[model samples]
Target: MTKNISPPEALIYAMVTVSAADRAITTDELNRIGSIVRELPPFRAYTDDWLADAAQDCGKLLRKPHGVENVLDLVKATLTPELYETAYVLCAEVAASDLAVHHEEEKFLALLASNLEMDDLVCAALRRAARARHHQL
Candidate 1:
């Protein structure tokens, strides 16, 4: 079942998914996600407490079945096309944070793209760009 989630909430969820893809969350990944959350335009007015609350909400959802779908839908519905594209780029960044993408990570990113109604070609491009970026890091 789908749940109602705001754009910012969805972005946080996306962050959670990327962070958890390896079955282990790293400090660098967490810090990167925190930075991304803080830089988002929708989160501009968020206080520290508010950001913490959102992070908690995302943490809860991560434990649910098909939770990623719900978050991607929220983001797809709420963000403009350009923003969604940006978010996809951000997802790539998150995936690359660990210096390598696992199979699970690739699947998760593909699923995220599907959830957002992005074309397969676009998803492939995103993956390629992400891998390239990771290699550069």
Candidate 2:
């Protein structure tokens, strides 16, 4: 049976997926995810263990066969079409948080775009914005 996830949970999965894309979840990426949850309007209602719990659930899903595909499918189903770009942007934010987008992360980003049916130009713009935001001083 397919599992159902809330929009907020879907968003967290998106971030978590990107963070784990490189096979390691860095401190910087975790911190970025926390800040995004704490500051984003969609996550305003999420508090305390909500983030951790959602991340853990996502991790579980990631461990199963075809886990990544399951996650992308779940996320695509949970969120509305308008939120697809936001989901992509959130993933980009996490991927770029550590200041380096690994090869796996790049592949995941492309997959995310394709799964969500996001426009190429829009994905490019969001990716550029993520890189710019994380640019070092």
User: What are the lDDT figures for the candidates, one per model?
Assistant: 0.72, 0.93
Worst 10 residues of 2 by lDDT: 1-10
After TM-score superposition, the amount by which residue 82's alpha carbon in candidate 2 deviates from its true location, in angstroms, is 0.8
CA lDDT, candidate 2, residue 66: 93
lDDT of 2 at 74: 96
User: Candidate 1 on 22-129: residue-level lDDT in tens?
Assistant: 788777677777777778786786676766787678667767886666566666776777666667767777877778777877787877777677888877787778
lDDT score at residue 94, model 1, on the 0-100 scale: 82
What does candidate 1 score on TM? 0.78
lDDT of 2 at 128: 93
TM-scores of the candidates are: 0.78, 0.98
Per-residue error for 61 in candidate 1, Å, reads 1.7
